[model samples]
Target: MASFVIEGGHRLQGEIHPQGAKNEALQILCAVLLTPEKVTISNIPNIIDVNKLIFILGELGVKVHKIDESTYTFQADDIDLDYLESEKFKKDGSSLRGSIMIVGPLLARFGRGYIPRPGGDKIGRRRLDTHFEGFISLGAKFRYNKEERFYGVEAEQLHGTDMLLDEASVTGTANIIMAAVLAKGTTRIYNAACEPYIQQLSKMINSMGGNISGVGSNLLIIEGVESLGGCEHRVLPDMIEIGSWIGMAAMTKSELTIKDVSWNDLGQIPRVFQKLGINLERKGDDIYIPSQEEYEVQNYIDGSILTVADAPWPGFTPDLLSIVLVIATQAKGSVLIHQKMFESRLFFVDKLIDMGAKVILCDPHRATIIGLNHQSNLKATTMVSPDIRAGISLLIAALSAEGTSTIHNIEQIDRGYQNIVERLQAVGAKIKRVD
Candidate 1:
């Protein structure tokens, strides 16, 4: 465990570059198992979760070559299926939620996929029903060991079939798509998750000779192929991290320019911040945010309080609602944050409240935040980060508070963010990590 000691009430100015998408990297790494040829991937984020998955791949006997700090080439020409049954795998695979993704590629190529129930943030109920159900729909036999909390799927021969997912789960959609890509027939997946990560996976698979259509849409059509070959792919910059940087700039009133943001891929994130009265200017794929003394949150056109909620793609991402809630605490007007996806994600608002932000926790799924208008600065406090998104939100709050703030359990932050202390220090933020 580690803590972040921050000296607040300081303005920072500089350029920041977001790391490659963590969610995308998970799927892309697993896709390598579908091919025996070399697959090169660039812009890979060096974070705990992604690194853990890469280690698991290496343990499974994939030949990993480091091209540079941010790029790697993987060759899955030989795999040790026995590793899936090893005690070491039970421990390693269960530690990262992203490890669940390897199941799809394994089930497609080796006829068996096994993983101890994976773990990650303690946000809420993250069910694997969508994944197992989709596998079952694709003619895979499902098995679970209740005592060990382990799950497995097997298929002698996969035959694709059309399926309507119960929910548009991103990982679930990705897993099914990977498994379906190698099946014997065409698989049409409706109500699929079309997040940028999923679209990127589909595109990468297409370049590797997988026939996939209806990209960037909720309905995906995949015609099974015999085998996949290798192709080079570059991951997009993490959108969630980009949103957090935008929120930090507003809260600290810093003139920050984020480089290579891939503006069109940001969907509703920029507009969501704009609705909160944060100004964002695009200069040749870079996002330039000028310092503002105070920004006002916008109410509805009908003269009501604005409510921000999360939905599937083309909608505001649920991962950023915590940052949005924290940003609203300093705005001129009030806003309601409805976290429809996860029930426990809003629990960190208590830490915000203790720091002098006026917030009303409306049950487990919603909260109401009244703007402080910067008339009074938040008093410094000590808190513990419960999850990755909330951890970053608290870090933003700490940066804008009156005095020094201490945040413990920063391993959650490290799970998603890459070199956060160094990156912030480069941007003139007085932050340090206490190991």
Candidate 2:
């Protein structure tokens, strides 16, 4: 295990580039299995989860070649179908949540897919029913082995049909889209997730000879093709990382410029930070955040306290709520953060409270933060990170605290952010990764 030892009260300054979108990379990487042609991808983030998925592909007999530091070409021409039933696959597939996505493409190409019980952040109940139901709706047989705790889907041939998802689950939608693109006839999906990641996946599939429409909406149309071909695709910048940097700048009173953030695809992220009274300037495609002594929260027009909640795309992302909640600790006013998607994500507020911030955990999903207004700095303390988003949020808090802080279990942060210590060090942050 590794930990980050951070000395507080240092102002970070300079320009930092956001890595490629982690979510999009997961879906796009798995999409390579839909075709035997060579698919080249650029701007792939060098992170643990992504690297694990790429390694899993190699274990499945996919040819993976490194073109450069952030580029790779994948060819799934000779897949090892028998490996899916191996004990090694069960251990590997259970390591990351993204491994579940391989099932869709495998089923489409080889008529069968198998995966062990997937594992990921323990934020809330992340169910796989939506994924299996979508596959079953497409004429696939779904089976679960209770003793082994494994899921398998098989079909002689998949024929497209109309599917109205119970919820617009992002991974669920991506899995179904991959399966539908190779089915016979047409498939229409309603209440589908339309996040930029999903839109990019659809675009990448189209580039590879698949037909899909309604790129940025809840309704999607896919006309199954006989096969897919190779294509090159580039991932968008990571919005979650952008939001985290914005929060870090505000908390530490730093001047930082996040470079080449896909402004068109950020949805409600910028405005959400603005609601917390963070100053942001858009210089072309970049976001420049000026150093701040303090930022105040804005109340509602009707005289109610401001409430920041997470919803589907076009709304505030749940991933950024942790950063928002942490930044709110230093703001001049109070705000309510509602994490509707995951019930237990707000429990980290207890740690912030221990650091002298006023926070009331209303429940598992809601937290009311009364900003300290910089009257006193947060006192440094030792703590453990529960998950990726929460870990980064705590690191931001530590950077703005009065004394040095040690955060254990920083592997969660590394799973999402690439070279975090090195990146922050270049921008004047006094942080080190200790093993």
Candidate 3:
């Protein structure tokens, strides 16, 4: 396994451009199976998760070619759906939570799909019931084998219907959209997930001749077509990465500028960071973060200690809650970090507490952080990453610490971040990837 050795207390001051959205790119890549023509995706992040999905696509007999460093051309004209049932395919496919996305497109285009249990952060119990429910509503029959932990779906005809998901799960909405894009009738999905990722998938489907409306909203209407032709689309900028950079710049008291951020796509993230006393100055497509000694953590609307929580789209992303929690430890005032999405995400507070930050873990989901206020410097130590976001948050914390820090389980970080150490090094961060 590889680890990151970060020499802390170095200010990072340079321009950084985030890669394409990892979350968005995963679903879009799977959607390529809906067409036989070449589906060209630009600005795609070259990350571990994306690469893993490409490997899975290749195993399924899809011809995937890299056009450039950040562009990919996928042609599934000769896709062999039988490979999806292979044990190696199931094993490799189960390594990512995004593998479930292939079910919809596979079932839509081939009338049957098989998937093993998908893997990701053990943050919380994310159920696939919503996704299966949507598939059943679209006329798919499902069978689950507990011994193998595999899910199978088959249907003669996937006719669209009016369906309402119990939870606006991101992958659930994506699965249904991919399935419905080639179904026979109109499908109305109310309470759908409208995250930028889902909207990007919808745009890609529309470009391929699927009729989709009400993108970026809770309600989605899809008019099924006989088939979809391949079209080219670019992945959107990673807002979460941009947000992570914002938190990193604030924590290290560095003057940094983030380039090419889609200003219009950032929903309430800037305001949420402002509540933590971090200010962002927008100059066209760039976001400027000036160096600051300290930021005051404000109270909530009720005048009590402020509690920042995560919700679905139109809300702060759950992925950034860990970053915010780490940043709050350096703020001037106290605040509550509410991680409603994941039960075990707050467990890392014990590591931060060992570094001398005053934190009270209320439970598995909440932590109260009392800032160090630039008066204290965290003593460097060795730690292990538990998940992708937690790993990056630990990296940011390590960079802001007083001495050198070693973070193990860097594979967790690489799963989502593309060439993270290389990118950070370019911006003056003294980090080395060691095995």
Candidate 4:
């Protein structure tokens, strides 16, 4: 296993760009299987999860061409559907949560999809009920093998139907939309996830000759097409990574520039950081954050403690809540970090507390942070990265702490962040990866 050795209290300054979104890449990559034509995708982040999916696609006999580190053209003209039932796929597919996405396109075009229970983060109970339920509504037969812990869905030909999602799961919506795009009849999906990632996938599907309407909204209507062709698409910059940089700049008191951020697409991200008194200005496509000695959290007009919670799309992303919690440890006022989505994500707060940050773990979903206000610097210590978001948040804490810090289980970080050590090093951060 590799770990990060950080010499703390190093002020970093330089321009940084957020890599292509990990969530978006997973959905878009899986969509290539919907058409036999060549689908070109650029700005694909070279991370562990995305790479794993691309490799799985190749193993399934999708013709893959690597244009550059960030671009790929995939032609699924010849697919080995039998690979889904092979032992090799069970082992490989079980390692990545994104592998579940392969099911939608496979079942749509080939009539059957099989996958082992997928794995990714241990955040909480990320159930697949929504995804399978959507498939079932679309006339697919579902089966589970208890001994093997495998899930399979099959249908001779899908006929679309109207359904309302129990939850606005982003991946669920993507999977359902992908499957619905090829169904025989019209599909009306109410209460769908309208995240930028979903909208991007919808746009790509439309560009490929599918008919989809009511994009960027909770209700989506898809008139199924017999087939889809290939098209070119580019992923948007990762907003969560950009938000993480904002917290990093504030915690380390560093002046930084984040280039090519899709400013308008960053709903509530900038405002949420601004609420922490972190001053950032949008200079064209770049965001400039100046060095600040102190920042105070904002309270409601009624003089109540500010509570930051996660919600569905058009709301603050749950992925950045961990970053918000860590940076709050140094703000002048107290704030409640409500992680409504995942139960165990707040478990990393114990590590932050060990680093000398004042935090109260209310429960699995809530924490109260009393900012140290720069009058006190966090004491550095060794910790372990629990998940992708928690790992980055801890890295920010380590960089702002007074002494050298060590973070174990850094592979969790690499699962989502693309060349994180290299990027941080370029921006003057004293970080290095070691075995």
lDDT of 3: 0.91
lDDT of 4 at 51: 96
TM-score of each: 0.99, 0.99, 0.98, 0.99
- Estimate the overall C-alpha local distance difference test score of candidate 1: 0.96
- Report residue 362 deviation for candidate 2 (angstroms): 0.5
Q: Name model 3 segments beyond 4 Å from true.
A: none
lDDT of 1 by residue, 1-435 (tens): 789999999999999999999989999999999999999999999999999999999999999999999999999999999999899999999999999999999999999999999999999999999999999999999999999998999999899999999999999999999999999999999999999999999999999999999999999999999999999999999999999999999999999999999998999999999999999899999999999999998898899999999998988999999999999999999999999999999999999999999999989999999999889888899999999999999999999999999999999999999999999999999999998
- Please give the CA lDDT of all the candidate structures: 0.96, 0.95, 0.91, 0.96
Q: Give the poorly placed runs of model 4, Cα more than 4 Å off.
A: none
- What residue pairs are clashing in model 4? none
Clashes of 1: 0
- Candidate 1's displacement at residue 147, Å, is 0.7
lDDT of 2 by residue, 91-192 (tens): 999999999999999999899999999998989999999999999999999999999899999999999999999999999999999999999999999999
Q: What is the lDDT of residue 136 in candidate 1?
A: 96
**Poorest 10 consecutive residues of model 2 by lDDT?**
347-356
Write candidate 4's Cα lDDT for 1-435 as tens digits: 999999989889999999999999999999999999999999999999999999999999999999999999999999998899899999999999999999999989999888999999999999999999999999999999999999999999999999999999999999999999999999999999999999999999999999999999999999999999999999999999999999999999999999999998899999999999999999998999999999999999999999999999999999999999999999999999999999999999999999899999999999999999988899999999999999999999999999899999999999999889999999899999999
